[model samples]
Target chain A: MFSVMPDSAVRIRDLRKTFGSVEAVAGVDLDIGDGEFFSMLGPSGSGKTTVLRMIAGFERPTSGTIELGGRDVTSLAPFDRDVNTVFQDYALFPHLDVLRNVEYGLKVRGVPRAERRERARAALRSVRLDGLDGRRPAELSGGQRQRVALARALVNEPKVLLLDEPLGALDLKLREEMQVELKSIQRRAGITFVFVTHDQEEALTLSDRVAVLDRGRIEQVGTPAEVYERPATAFVAGFVGTSNRIGAVRVRPEKIHVGIEPDAGSGGESGGPAEDGPGRDGRAEGGAGTGDRHAFGTVAEVVYAGPATRFVIDLESGDRVVALQQNLRTSSMDVTRHRGARVRIGWHAEHEFSVPETGAGTAPAS
Target chain B: MTAVAGRPAPGLRRRAAALLHRRPLLRLSLLLSAPLAWLVVAYLGALGAIFLTAFWTTDTFTGEIVREFTAVNFQTLWDEPVYRTIALRSLGVAVAVTAIDMAIGLPMAFYMAKVARPRHRPMLVSAILAPLWAAYLVKAYAWRVMLAEGGPVDQALEPFGLSGPGYGLTATVLVLSYLWLPYMILPVYAGLERLPGALLDASGDLGARPLRTFRTVVLPLVYPSLVAGSIFTFSLSLGDYITVKIVGGRSQLIGNVVYDNVGAANNLPFAAAVATVPVVVMLGYLAAARRTGALREL
Candidate 1:
């Protein structure tokens, strides 16, 4: 009922904010589609939180216009804006019970008593907190309190919901569970969600689309797979997950193939051209070409993770790359040995992408 | 096997520390007993003795306290119109002072805690507490002079054809409010300071205007501390006799009656009986505050 326009739930035009001398959020433009689960992903101090706060009206941009559903709300107060935020701390009122905390927004909007109760109850139920509505926030556990905060924000039925690291405080298991729960709730509610997180895995698992923020600027904005598989900058490549950098190109550890070199002592034998010989059946599954880009290196370290084993290799070409191999039906890591054994590693040429090379104490340009 | 050949089995200090570490309740009881004993004996015991004396009789002829248990003093206090008036006057003054201090302190404290610059916050706190540094008697006397006829206050209001509220109930109320303003502000400021910025931001984002936020979120969150602060103002005003004596021209409160009974009349039992009124009022006020969950903050 509060929305004035039909599409583009949130539209930010060249938004900027500076805290004295520090440019917290430099000029950035964004368009969030209606009913989209959009995430702003970054490392700490990457201006993702600042952008979310600006959209929620907690921060006034230095210069720009913000519109929700086509109505400009840049100058409007937070209360006047059709947006609600689930805070990082899950800021539930300690004095009020869960029901009252959930009903707070409606009560402030002068909602009728019985209707407010029903809406709050339904919101609580949506968060799986139906029977716990009478509990004070202090009495509830961390995850329960987080659900109360979510319920409190959701009962208002704002046009857009901003979540500022809402799952940052939970433990690993609880965080993973809440991630699935939050996404399901978003789907069921069909409200545009702008979730901010410094954790890349959380963003990738939850967002329909994600904007990669780097040092107060937008590095790239696309679907999670788009940002992950084809990062636009060296910083993004380094931040999202572990990427093996070979000069200007980056390839994931999982994409590289690792196996023993057939002839370890042969001086003229190179792994690439010497392939497609007898007893080379294992090399056919990977590497786009029959004799694709390959390197011969000695195993530096072997790390046996439960589902996968990672082998770090030091190439004779003076570059290093890590290759992760899944543990097939067998239980032992005997296939990849630790240290001093010469091995062959190869990856599809298309898996490699260009990224700038940056040295210590410097950030690569986007 | 790793022990040195010449080393003693264990030093007394190490052994004692190990024992203490193993028995936490014993350690805690040992640590708590001293302060707990002092609190019960020195503070609560004195209060118990005073309340006990409130039921005793005072011999009028010899100016001696008779140990016989009697309700004569309370009977006199209830029957007499003067005592009733004095108690009511004292209660009214205390309530007024508390109200005035809250009116001035809440906004000032809020500004200091939530809005002031980091560098300026300490200076604002210092300014609020600076007046408390002056001696209580000295401040009261200063107010006496300021409210005197042709004094600074009267002179300032001379051109407006108005005069100061010359030393009376009004003067007492004003001076007490001024004296205790920091007491009220400090607690409320500390409460507001500890309030996470995220809560206020969440309130605003939930479609609450600033005033509505204050009325609903900020006010309720800060209420316990506000009540904690009112405890200081109300009790101080209720039991104050020195400030009244310094600035009060003709006004007489419960404290004044107690003081007169104890000093001029040399009636200790009667004074003890009179003092019980303020104690009872304070207890009732505390009970009311506790029901609002303010005692938890305290």
Candidate 2:
């Protein structure tokens, strides 16, 4: 079911890497489009970084092939590959100044001194580190060093740029800032960027397409929205974003609505305030006319986050589900009052996705 | 509270500890006093006496130090062509030994630090250090036997229609390099061990081949440790007299001259004057090495 793109920048066929007895990158197939900002998103030890390293020729596949720009580079040394990696540690040469670190690739390739200097300076400018050429990597701040690493890799103008959690070392504010800068840089460079990160939010925010890896295998590969909305596997559903599994179906927290169940004699238009007691019945399911699946549950916990409030409900169907509500109209007091109150949780049928149960047992907790 | 029945009233040790805690500078001085005194008196005092004696002359008739400060000893050292030759030869041997040690030590250290499996590293380091546990004279004498006529070195070379350079500057340098090789390997190994593997990967990812990466990345970063290792090899080779005596047949080095004047001729002042040469050269070498910021690594 995998379509092979004729102009794909990177293509892998059953790529596998085994470290002794442990399989790191199990058999996998992928095709990354030219100039696409692709991300291999996974938790630590999920083999995303190994895949990226194999793509960069830092690693060799155990029994498969990796094609870069349609050339089989499985046996080539890292230097022979037309890709550069911005290491997780930045890996800027501690002995060289920023400009020289950027100019190293060109220098080794026998680029003339004057031309390489000019190109390196331009690269430094692209990363917005123009005046800090004389400063060594140790002299720069964390974010600045990260930029120098980016500039060093970018200066080569390789066919692909591999970034292995380049922003993982930065603080939250700086990482967010770098995310914007990196996206813009990738756009301007128009080089196929294969970014690897364990941060799901970063993968979703930065990548045009993301491959979610689990246990050395790709669980799902799709656009961020597709992975988030219609996760192919239960693992992807739980990993990419918060998923509330209700039996065989999964629904996002934000899509589930929690409301006070109306009394038996009350009209359907409005539900009166939920009584200060346990849910009316242990099990109830209705609202089929509106094509909405409904369940009766007691609000187990009410969490008031600043922008949104989360309600953890233990449904009567022997399953627990969390529902998120924006605080645009509900204040802290309004959401906090839902604790122990009888409520009806409902979601549109379209929002419910039936994920395969193969990897469900090993999916990370929501 | 009746002084807490059985508790001793501020024992001398407790009181001293409290006093020490209250006065940091006093405590620091007390902590450093013994070693500081030994360094100043025994080490610096001896060095100062040597420098002082280098300026003094001997009473030629009575065979005693005149205690009269004069440049005559230094003048004699300068005027004598043999002394100059020995000093230059000694300097040359130290430089050659250091060079040879580096050439061998670097790759050995790299293999031990980076290429070897992690579990095997400690064993490799101890292997490099195993020779150091033997007595210096024992090792030198062993080399002396090895370099003797029809010795292993000579017999090995005989099949190739060549003979070993028996007992001379070549033998001195060969033996000295072997003796000081551990010194070079240790620092270089520590430096290479401290070098992060990602830096090498990053260099290769930047399109530089392995050799280029070593030249551009590994060598420059490891240079400080190389200098640190050279400090040990250079100074040890420079001040060594026993090794040269064991292998050097007719050649004389600065250390040999210093020894000969003191032992055979009973010329303490002239011996001290000759001793100052290596000390001066070491000081110069240290200044240059410090400029490279290698002393910090040591």
Candidate 3:
């Protein structure tokens, strides 16, 4: 499966890095398509930044090779590699004006003075730092410094751009704005961008694909929608969003029959997978029926959020099912009306995704 | 309280409290005034006395200071080739010593400030400062023994058949350099240490080579320290009398000339005038150093 043809803008093969006794990045393989906004998401010590650093050539991998544009850059130094990094701290030269900072790479590449200035100005303008070219980094605000950092890297026109939590220091509103700005820039440049961030929402919002990392290893990799809707593991489910779990093999939303209530449902031995029945007592169990979900629960909590109403239902089989109902003009999932009321939770049997337990200990598979 | 409403107290206790509060300003002024007066009396007054003495003439008959003002002492300094040679030689030596000290001190300071591991750094800095903690007179006397004809340095050089003037100049530069090295290193090291580490990394990422980075980024950032250290080294070497006497091998510095005029020649007025030159030079260097960031640490 790993020996496929090189349709990727960047191919990472068996990449490994170690600092002292601590293995920062263990063996990993990945392929990022051209013009794709891919993000590596992880916690602080999860090796996301290490992988980004290796790609940027700030850190050399102890083993393996990095191929960009189908060219090997394993032993290449940072400047020699046709990739630029936007550091988290920005690392803008305090002594130089914004224009000079952006022009640094071009000058080193021996670009003509006038051409370099023109390119730098264009990059600055793209990042909305056109008129602030003469200002020093210390003179700029946090958001402005971030733009300058982005401009500095973009001015180089590298094959791949690596951003290490470039907007981590910004306020929430500013971060969202920059997320759109960065995505637009990536689209305009049509270049591969490997961004590193720990913010799950940011990764989901900006990334075409995201690789979740844990303990110097890739936990899972998928498109944002695929990972969010069909999380392969409990970690992905909990990390991407919130979830609730009860117990036993029960039924999913679409399979379970939703009746008003007959003596608060059956109170004895719970429902099991019948010979030709839809499912069983636990939502994530049973191979009884294809495209069939079943579960009965009391609507314990209903939260009417802005766009969707979230319902937390306690199943009769000692399980909880979380359901999100999109709020249309006349939707029935109102929390003030449904709270404490008994309701069966089910959806299209096809929409039910069962992720097998893998001893991950991830918030009861939610 | 009802009977005495709106009336202020004038009892003994209240009067005492009011007097005590009022006298704090007066007490503080009195306390600070003594040191201010002492500085004016001891430092400014002494300088003024020296300036006055510089214009007095020494009587040839009895070696007594003649009360009358005269330019005869200045004439002697101008007319004598020995005095002119000694003055030039002092400048030459001070400049050479300062240059060599700076060259070694700046890099050493850089290593201490930026490169040394935290666990080992304090010991190294203390070692540099250890020399200053010792008695300066004792260290100068120690060099006297070391630089003598049959001393350790000469004995060590006997095998190479090199021992006379080489010994004197080499010993002087070495001893002077060693004594003043800390003065130069600490300020420069502090400046380098206070520099932002992100700047170095940014410069490196921007494709500046190590040498280019040091020249453009590191050097300019530590200008204050360099200026401060150079002034300190030059001024300290200029005013030193014992170190030059020990290692100079009878070669005269301005300090030596002033000493000779006061002690051997009994020409106090001439010595006072010669001493005034260094004070002027030191004041000028200090002013310039302060304008830069050099004097900030001190």
Which order, best to worst by TM-score?
2, 1, 3
lDDT of 3 by residue, A261-303 (tens): 1221222425542211123232222221122444566667767
- Candidate 2 C-alpha lDDT tens digits along B148-241: 9999999999989999989988999999999999999999999999999899999899888899889989999999999999999999999999
lDDT of 1 by residue, A101-184 (tens): 999999999999999999999999999987987888889999999999999999999889999999999999999999999999
DockQ of 1: 0.80
Q: Over the stretch B55-159, how does candidate 3's per-residue lDDT look in tens digits?
A: 998888987789898877778888999888877777777788899988999889888887887678888889899989899889887878877778887788889
Ranking, lDDT, top scorer first: 2, 1, 3
Candidate that beats the other on TM-score, 1 or 2, i.e. the better one: 2
lDDT of 1 by residue, B177-211 (tens): 99999999999999999888788898898888999
In candidate 2, position B221 carries an lDDT of: 90
Residue-level lDDT of model 2, residues A259-295, one tens digit each, is 6432331134335433224535312333211226878
Q: Candidate 1, which segments miss by more than 4 Å at Cα?
A: A1-7, A260-291, A358-366, B1-5, B9-37, B118-120, B155-161
Of the two candidates 1 and 3, the one with more favorable DockQ, higher being better, is 1
